[model samples]
Target: MAAGHYGLSNLIAIVDHNGLQIDGTNEEVMDLHPLDAKWSSFGWHVLMVDGHDHEALLDAYQEAEKQDRPVVLIANTVKGKGVSYMENQVEWHGKAPSDAELVQALKELGGDPS
Candidate 1:
C-alpha cells in the first residue's frame, strides 16, 4: 500500500505460494485462497505463474518491470521442489535432511553426490 502511494515502480514482491507450511497444506492449516485477487484488491499488478519453471520466473520479472505500480508475483510451487521424498511433505519444513536423505535428494536433483 505504501509503495503504491509513493509510486515505487522498482518494488516487486514475489510470494512463493507453495500451499504447504510447517503443519500441513495451506488449505488444511489456514487457507489463503484467491491470493492474486487479494493482491489485486490492494492495487498491485499480480502475476501468478509456476514457480518451478525458470523461464516462467524470468518472464514474470520482465513483465513486472514494465508495470508502473508495485507488482507481486505469486509463484505457485511445491515445498520441497526438486527432492522427491520431501516434496509437499510438511515434516520437512523445519527439519534438515538426514545424511541418507541428503544423498537421495542430491541424486534426485542431479547434483554430483561427491
Candidate 2:
C-alpha cells in the first residue's frame, strides 16, 4: 500500500468518509468504524470535521498546523455537495456531468462549481 510504504508518518491524509465506497455502500465492502483509532495506529493525530462548513474547515486547518506530528483532518463530505439530486447519493461517485447537468450543478453551487 502507498500509505504504509510512502514514508507517510509525517503525512496527514484527510480521507472523505461519506460512508460510501466505489460499490453500493462502505458497510458492504468493509467495516471501517472506529476510524480514528485505525489512523492513530498509523501514527497520525485525527480531527473530524463538518465537511460542508467553511468555518469548521478553517479552524481545523489552523489546529492541524499547530500540531507537531501528522494530523489527519477527516472531513465527512457528501458525494455531490450543492447538487439537487446527488448530494450524499453514491450514484454520482465517479460519473462526469453532461452539458445540461454541468449547468444545473453550477447554478446549485452559487453559479460556480469552480
Candidate 3:
C-alpha cells in the first residue's frame, strides 16, 4: 500500500502462489481469490505467470520493468512440483524428507541420486 501510495515504480513484489500455507491449502485457510484485482486496486501493475516456466517468468519481469506503478508478479505453482509423494501434500511443508525419500525424489526428477 505504501509503495503504491508513494508511486514506487521501482518496487517489485513476487508472490509464490502455490495454494498452500504452513497449515493447509489457501482455500481452507483464507481465500484470497481475485488476488490480481486486489493488487490492481492498490495501484499496482499486476502480472500473472506460471511459476515453473522460466521463459514466462522472464517475460513477466521484462513487462514489469515497463510499468509506471508498483509491480506484483503472481507466480502460480504446484507445491513440491516434481516429487510424486510430496506434491500437494501439506504434511511435507515443514517436514524434511528421509535419506530414502530424498533418493526417490531425485530419481523421480531424473537426477543422479549417487
Per-residue CA lDDT of model 1 for 79-107, tens digit only, reads: 99888888888898899988888989999
In terms of lDDT, which candidate is stronger, 1 or 3? Answer: 3
Full-model lDDT, candidate 3: 0.94
lDDT of each: 0.89, 0.79, 0.94
List residue ranges in candidate 3 displaced over 4 A. Answer: none
RMSD of 1: 1.1
Tens-digit lDDT track of model 3 for 1-114: 899999999999999899998889889899999899999999999999999999999999999999899999999999899999999898888899999999999999999999
Model 2 clash pairs are none
**Candidate 1 colliding pairs:** none
Q: What lDDT is reached at residue 17 by model 2?
A: 75
Ranked by lDDT from best down, the candidates are: 3, 1, 2
| Candidate 2 structure quality by residue, lDDT tens digits, 1-114 | 345445454566678878887777877788798888887787677899988889998998888777666778888887787788788777788889898899889888888655
Angstrom error at residue 73, model 3? 0.8
